[model samples]
Target: MARRALLSEAWWQQATIIPDNEREIAKHYTLDRSDLELIMRQNKAANRLGLACVLATLRYPGRPLADGEVLPAGVLRFLARQIGAPWESLQYYPLRDFWRDGKQMISA
Candidate 1:
């Protein structure tokens, strides 16, 4: 099983601004505009996770993601499965720390 990774408050803060950074994040991920629109239309959870993936990728471009700097692969996989997306499409970090000491939904 893949280990669980935690997202830092700083990363969460950055993710919260996804609406304002949509274009940039999408561009960085090479996401097609139509596909982005489709994801947005899926549901709130899917939209959030999709945006989170894009933001995470933009935050950590290369390999060896920094501590608490990337979303857990398990979390990404779960979200992708929930939204009917392929898990292999996203590049997220593996488990490391717990988000908010396990209070966060993503950590559960």
Candidate 2:
């Protein structure tokens, strides 16, 4: 299994301001864009990957689904649509849970 890594202190620097730096990030992960960017500025490319890692970890479920089949919802689907991919589909699948978690479903 691919282990989820934590975001390094540097990711705060490189993170683009999305919604607000406070409500969107700090309230949850206790770290914000500034914090992440600072870490990135102090580190290198490999360290930047921590941005995605930390975000994913911070966004990790409050609890694993009892059925283990909880899929992305409508909002996420719409976002995915914007990111159109040949394999994209309306079906739901956690990034890590296609075959192991449930049936594979795709959307476009």
Candidate 3:
């Protein structure tokens, strides 16, 4: 969510900031624990969704559509290919799980 990826920054730049040229990077860029946490959560969610799409495709072979459902584009094709389904029948879009009807909200 937050662009806090600073592999270029120094590990010991904090103590030597401003006055010390060695820690000059710390002045230019700031990274904290919360930034790291956001990155981690985003990575986890992405990995989980990717895995879920794969599993869904595997569960339903040949037919990319679950029932009367239609998938958008990108992710669908990827998952379909992952599970040996027809890419043409696949769709990729954002989906949200709804508890009320056990349904998914697919975006167009």
Candidate 4:
């Protein structure tokens, strides 16, 4: 028989378990000046917020964000407030190449 996976599917989907509490959210998801500069370089509001989420995922959960992954609401609110975008305006974020591209660029 094949060996069972050690980590849960949720671990593959980083940012899946980010805490929703205000202090924990701020601790893990706050965008710093460099992060803000990078996020601001993205073309549009949605892209900025999307990139921020990806960056946070890479930093905390230390893995690539899975497609269609839903981030914790507190994390979203923290990033959105920093990027000055509405938290509900991530219309262009879902499963988009923008996220993968940003992930690649950031990793590079």
Candidate 5:
């Protein structure tokens, strides 16, 4: 899915609520300090959500979720409700950028 299609006016509205401090959450999750800082820099909701998706996928010990792949309907609905985004829009929101950027910082 294209990045442009992923973002909508509703997506911005849903992301209005700034997430809790990433630093604290990172500590709780045992994420590396450097990686936590990188995540902190992504102030937008889409980017943050992408980061969350990456982290959530990492918790499972298997092939990670890939960009452009449709998430399970239930999981997508749950995330949409939690973040106040339109559920259908999530299908286009790929995690590639978030994962790549996150990996670069964490690996550096």
Candidate 6:
């Protein structure tokens, strides 16, 4: 049987992005110096970005990233700049979704 969604798409959309406020972005997405050091240890620009984004999602949303998740622009900018990466480098970070056994897979 196909799995069902636990929440409405509309609600998830709302939940995914911070409201583009500076204070809110800072509050939710700010990485500590320790986390920044850890993220920077990632080999590639994309890897650094991916790790930081995953941490941000877990910090604010209390969950790991979902497939095709769109983070807030301000939050993305915050994280990329904090990591010393070009904001557009995000294009190099691949989506985590994968196909397996005739189904789209999400990690538990």
Query: Using lDDT as the measure, which candidate wins?
Result: 6
Please provide, for model 5 over 1-103, each residue's C-alpha lDDT reduced to its tens digit, 9 standing for 90 to 100.
6555667889754543222444533333343556456555754556545554565446522235554554455554444454445666444345434445346
Best by TM-score: 4
**Residue-wise C-alpha lDDT for candidate 4, range 26-57, written one tens digit per residue:** 88888779989898988778889889988998
lDDT for model 5, please: 0.48
What is the Å distance of residue 39 in model 4 from its true position?
A: 0.7
Ranking by TM-score: 4, 6, 5, 1, 2, 3
| Model 5 poorest ten-residue lDDT run | 16-25
lDDT of 3: 0.38
Clash pairs, candidate 1, are 4-95, 5-95, 5-96
Write model 6 residue lDDT over 9-77, tens digit each, in one string: 999878865457888888888899899989988767877988898898888877876677688778888
TM per prediction: 0.27, 0.22, 0.21, 0.69, 0.36, 0.68
Clashing residue pairs, backbone N/CA/C < 3 A, model 5: none
The segments of candidate 3 whose C-alpha lies over 4 angstroms from its true place after superposition are 1-43, 62-108
Give the worst 10-residue stretch by lDDT in candidate 1: 91-100
The residue pairs that clash in candidate 3, if any, are: 71-91, 73-92, 76-91, 76-92
User: What is the lDDT of every predicted structure here?
Assistant: 0.49, 0.36, 0.38, 0.78, 0.48, 0.79
Clashing pairs in 4: none
| Residue-wise C-alpha lDDT for candidate 1, range 30-80, written one tens digit per residue | 445564565566334534455646544554453333455545555455446
